[model samples]
Target: MTEIYQKLENIVKKEFISNSLIVRHAYSRVVDPVLQGIPDIVIRPKDAKEISEILKVANEENIPVIPRGGGDDEFGGSKPIGDGGIVLDMKRMDNVLKLDEDNLIVTVEAGISWGKLDEYLCHYGLYTGCMGPGSGMTASVGGGISHQSVGGGGCAKYGACTNQLVSLEVVLPNGDIIETGSQANKFSKIPFNRFGNGPDLAGLFCGDNGIMGVKTKVSLQVFPRPPFAAYKTFLLPRKDRQVSSQIMLDVRRKGIDVYDLMYIMDLIMRVGCDQGMFPMWEQLKKKRGIIFYTVEANSEAELQEKVKQLDTIILDNKCEALGPEISDGNIAKWHYVEQGHWQFYHNLWGMVPALEPLSCECFVPANMYPTILDDIDQWDMEHAKDMEIFTKVTGMRPITGSGPIFLIDGNNVELTCGFTSFPSYYNGENHEGWDELNLKLWKSLMGMLTTKWGVQWYMMGEMASRIMAQLDAYLPDYYKTLKAIKKVLDPKNILSRGKFEFWGDGNK
Candidate 1:
């Protein structure tokens, strides 16, 4: 065996990676699967110590390393970004370090799936305040933190996933297992006002996308899972941007937590995930539509009240209906049976580029989701005629973006959107002009959004400038300090190789 192979075997199980193409496909990314030469071996580390050893070996041999959890970022984050490297699958490292139900906080390994976390916690009548749709399968706590994921829920009530992070247990490339915040007791007593003592160490790696170092364990804030549940899914018909905005605004006016969400159907995708559809990409090439709806409430009573209000709004506002699907009324229960929300999204679309920009989420203050859509709708109408731009507006009531506890009362009001734009972009049927069209549309919309809209979409994906653009607004000096820390911490750039650069190029 090669020196690299020998080193990998010394640390973790070797069967983590197999030579078969089938294995490669399972481990690969949605966009560029065959990265760097498909890592010679995959390793599974059980704890921070083992992770440290794996990183040390990779650094010594100068091999690439990709630390993956939940296996969700099929585009690039999880798949091999380099060759002959080791893919650290932390899926087996799932151990809930601490579940302080009283304080509403839980510490978990990066490998724990979001759904699993939600399900386990739900049993105790408590749920993660940072629950996303994927909180139900493949979404990992670490991965969500990396992307700063703002799933359909909690986003309106608990802040983004990163906001729930109270502490972190990270492993740097040099084999140092450092604990950033107080394990449990210590962190709880900290000013709670200053985030953490001194420099706020936990903030550095929260959304670094696994570039700075490997996130082995995470500490997150939890919430009452709510004994009663409701999962009402509404279907908006056609492209009535004005009415959609009005409905969302109305919900907030009446005090409802909308947990924002959005979806647009440009023919190909809807057929796949829609109830009775098979997603035969070849036949369903003519279905251009939109689904503007909301999940309603976090409780059964709240859900029913919201349903009545929604009926009034739809009727009064004059919007068409796709259909009124019954609210499951048991969201936490459904979350478990469904595996996870990544399973939710994955089940919806069948045949598209695995890397198809799943969804781009960001916040421009509260009550802005609708306003942003209003702006985009106006722009689309004026600029393009050959194209038909549809709109689906979903809002989170009792918006989580609020202060103190992202909770909703009569006075507080805010809204956010899941904002999706997968218009006319598919792999097989319209592979000709669809690529250019999709690229043009995505770029145009995003470019306008960042510049004209004047607000940042934090989880839109990793664009050096766009991601960096968030530096000053929400977190000042965060990037500069993070880069400097990466230099001092790793200096070898062998940890999460593609996440952030440390020291110099080719350091390891």
Candidate 2:
């Protein structure tokens, strides 16, 4: 056994530290099929103390330690980048520490799945406000918070995972255990507050993507479940993207208690049609946009009033109601495929045959949606013709794009827009060749979006380091401060090396 393995074994039990080839291989694999790096060892720590000890040893030896929770991120965040090191799997630490119903707060170990937590909270008629990712069934609480995922039930109302986060118990790279937010207070029994009479230290780790530290536990604010829910669907003219975007803005501006508002673009409709997923695709073939919205209220009267308000806004935007047939069917299918027992693995593993999907989640200005969609369409057309990939003979098409924008804050429409791209590749027989082309296309598209629209990548993983580096150049002082923090917190840079690459050395 290697010296590092010997040291890790001392920190955890021998059963917890495995250097076996099979185990290491399994640990190396992630949701992204294109990116995989086998770690030297896979270590499962049962608690933060064990993680702290492991970090200390890793720091001393200058070995990279990548903390992984669920390994379900579509972006290559959890996968090792530099020379392989240790994969610190936190699944063994799964626990629901406390449920402070009085303050409407829940404290859970980072490794607990969001689905599990939501299930447990349902018994109490309470739920987290944050919109979990489609993979919430297996996606851990720490994973969602670290990545800042935005989608599920709370998209229109409470925003992303970061919004629901109240506090965090993190293990810094130097192996120091620190609690951020109100949890740091001596007399605090519940971490219901976020600011904590300080400069929002908890916010620092919210979207840091595990680059800052390993989140061992998290405290999130919860809300009582709404008693009533309703859904609606609107069909917008194919040529007018602004109408749908405006309608979404109006919903937030009017302070509608919207649970989820999803805008499905034409390209997505076509893809769904191609996959035979949407039977109503024929009717929407000429339509440019379809919107599905879910509103919630404490009473049926309130729900009806909200729906009436939504209808007025829809008609004002020159959108036609597609009736409940489309909306209810889509919502039912969404719940069945996502929240139900169907095991929604299609997000990571491409469901459509011979096609590999890659999504670039971003937060852009609300007003830029139309222009961005236009640009993407133009790019798709040009690239499709040039690459000879979009042909009837090949049964392959251009990179079809769709975005569902969510409001981060109802008060400020400018700050509300969260847009994400769903792009795919038709691999056919040559998987390797197509995968290479897909990666190249994906990077090019990302570069265009970042350069032209100033879109911020939602999942700041290794793939996003270059973009972060460029963004850092625009704010050298801020990045310098971050680098300094990294130096102090992780002197040896053992935790998530090559992530948020602003340090002088690539690994550091």
Candidate 3:
């Protein structure tokens, strides 16, 4: 290991390589409470060339190379799960390489934060079409692309990270550089298109979670920043989950250009009310769900016209408007805190008051939302009884949480619905046992989601890998093909070794 570390230092300079216990420990910890893997060494390469050299060395020596960006992976995708290996930290490569306003695209280094890219583009009256996750402030563009993250702005209109991507420059496992998308053309000057002459190679790497290769540069589609934006909120009556789901489906089917739509359940609202985080809590305490919409347009007139149309849909669906004051205030607060190197969602941690928060997210079809929610509610009721009693007796908060599902796309018959659970504690005396139980329950729930609910999408990390493996029996060829592709691209299994391994190579 010492000899390998010395060789790595020579590849990217001694200052860029670290084998210190503290550094390795920091690299090991992920957002999950219990999932952790310590790497033997960490390397911060300056560019794709440096990364290529590092990969070459690792591949030749048959050492695992885990490519990481931001290191904010909640699913343990960037962690070193195999025997201790090298963590290729990509943060040092942060830079916006180009902003082609004429072509309506921006080329950026893989390590650049989504927040930084948005801030830089705002000055030029442009923004990326697909916004990032809650951790956008710290999450890198490559990391989001690798994970295919959802949420943020424009998701309702533009879909997820892969939808915004136009091209990518990646370093393969054997130290070979390749450009995908329109950029692959020898005469291409800009990455304005996604599909080129042949196969869409860029699409292959989008959500693979770093198992395929190391992305060094990314080109994404950007849109003109809307000058006028409108916000509205509606309260769905309790006992009308079907009606609530139907209303959203109608709004989506109507082709309303909703920039952002968030469905906050009653449980989340109650928690926010107790934490004093939401000012409209008093007015909406009894509501079954709160639906928030942010619509943007080129002019105030256009924005008002869209809002008027949305109003009719809300009224026709028997939903009550929460008024502009409450709705706009909440939207403004989120924007203010999330813009410019901000971490708005961090405040939610205070409510859970946990050292580390554990969450499980899944993407189910839009039509399945109500049924899935009902199933989860039943599961929570049955499983949370013991934790509730334990917390009550110990003077600690119970392990309770909520799942917020948002519709990403509406044009397709099978719309994408992103469901995320609120954070829960997994620490403290006596709580450790509950934590283990909760983890097991969460994993089982994930399995059920993919199997019973027909969920077809997942976020990056080890959980996704496990879910894929769990569902492999239903799609043997799909898993086999993925493994075959992995073998071809990374023959030595050096890059992100044991990650997304569905071939039964002892990774599971």
Candidate 4:
């Protein structure tokens, strides 16, 4: 390991590489309470060429190489699945390479955060559609593309961040650097399209979860920010879950061009208000579920028409409108004008101190979520006995529910459903058996959500990806084809090894 560390140091100067225990320990964990893996070395490469050299060395040594961007991923996608390997930190490569305003395209180093990129684009009155992810303040563009991420503003209009992709520069597991999209043509001077040269190979790297290759550079289409905009929030009647789901379906069915539409469940409203997480809704007499909409347009007429259509759908469903001001429970105004999207998308995770989330993010049809949400309630009841173990120790039962249901592209919605509980090391004490119980409950919930609900998981990281593979959740031919592709692109399985049971020979 020391010799390998020295070899990596030679690739990315000694100052940028570390084998210290403290540094490796820091790279081992992510937002999850689980400690996924420990790294033998952590190296930050400044460019694709340096990453190419590092990958070559790792391939020769048959060592695992995990590419990490920003380390803001909650799914453990950037960490290794084993005890020791090299964690390639990509933050050093953060830079905007180009901005072709004429063509409405912006090229950037993959490690650049969405917030930084947005700030840069805002200077020119442009923005990246889908604005990366809910954690876009620090989540890297590479990580967002790797997961087809959503939940940020404009997801209703732009879908995933990958939807606007024009090109990508990826370093394969075997150290070969290749450009996808129009750049695949050797003589092409600029990347303007994603589908021309041969296949849409850029897609192979998108949402690959760090298994196919390391993303180094990316080019995405930028949209001009509209001048006309309007937002509204509505309080729902009883049976809010079913009612909220219907509102989302109607918004899609009526062809409403909304920028953002979200369903905040009653649990979040009540708990968030009680915990003071939602100051805007403090005065609401009924803390039931609420739905909000944000719309933007090139003209005031278009914006008004969209708002009028949306208001009719929301009001006809027996919902009461909050005041136009954000202070009067109008969260949509704050979400758009004040940049509250990043802060509130995952607020439920911090509803209680020291309670961490074991969550699953997935896409499901708008109509199916009400049933899924109800099933989650039933799931909570079924797990009451197991939850009591935590309640006995901490006097607080684990809280299980779905966070805000975000209306994403098409007729789908993004569901961030999970339970939060005290970590095994709560209050700085290691409680035996707590870790095992947490894993057991997490796996069980994941199994139920996947098998019974048939939801499509977009960000299956170390734990969820492995559990899905182990549970035989995927069809036989689909699994076989994925393995074949992995074998072809990553023969040694050195990149993101052990994911989907693709551990390299003798490594398992």
The true-versus-predicted C-alpha distance at residue 88 of model 2, in Å, is 1.4
lDDT of 4: 0.88
Candidate 2 per-residue lDDT, tens place, 333-403, comes to 35422452124334324546545455566776566777787887777766765356424435554455654
TM-score of each: 0.69, 0.89, 0.91, 0.98
- For each predicted model, how many residue pairs clash, with residues at least 3 apart or on different chains? 23, 1, 0, 0
Candidate 3 local lDDT, 184-261, one digit each (tens):
887887787889679999888988889999999999989997788877777777645566567668778788887766
Predictions ranked by TM-score, top down? 4, 3, 2, 1
Candidate 4 stretches with Cα past 4 Å from truth are 504-508
lDDT by residue (tens digit), candidate 4, 1-508: 7788788888888899998889999999888887478888899999999999999998889898889987867767788876888899988878999999999999999999998999999999999979888888888999999989888799999999989999999999988999998899899898899997698999888888999999999999999999989989999999998898888899899988789999999998998898899999999989999999999999988888898899999999999999999999999999989888877755767788988888888899998999998898899999999999999988888899988898898999999998987788887788888878888888888899899988898887776777778788889898889899989988878898887785532234
lDDT of 1 by residue, 314-364 (tens): 557654343232232222223333433344455433233332332333455
Pick out the ten consecutive residues of candidate 1 with the lowest summed lDDT.
396-405
The prediction achieving the highest TM-score against the true structure is 4
The lDDT of each candidate is: 0.53, 0.71, 0.72, 0.88
Ranking 3 against 4 by TM-score, winner? 4
**lDDT over C-alpha atoms for residue 304 of model 3:** 89
Model 2 segments more than 4 A misplaced = 279-288, 325-349, 389-395, 411-436, 470-473, 504-508
Best of the candidates, lDDT = 4
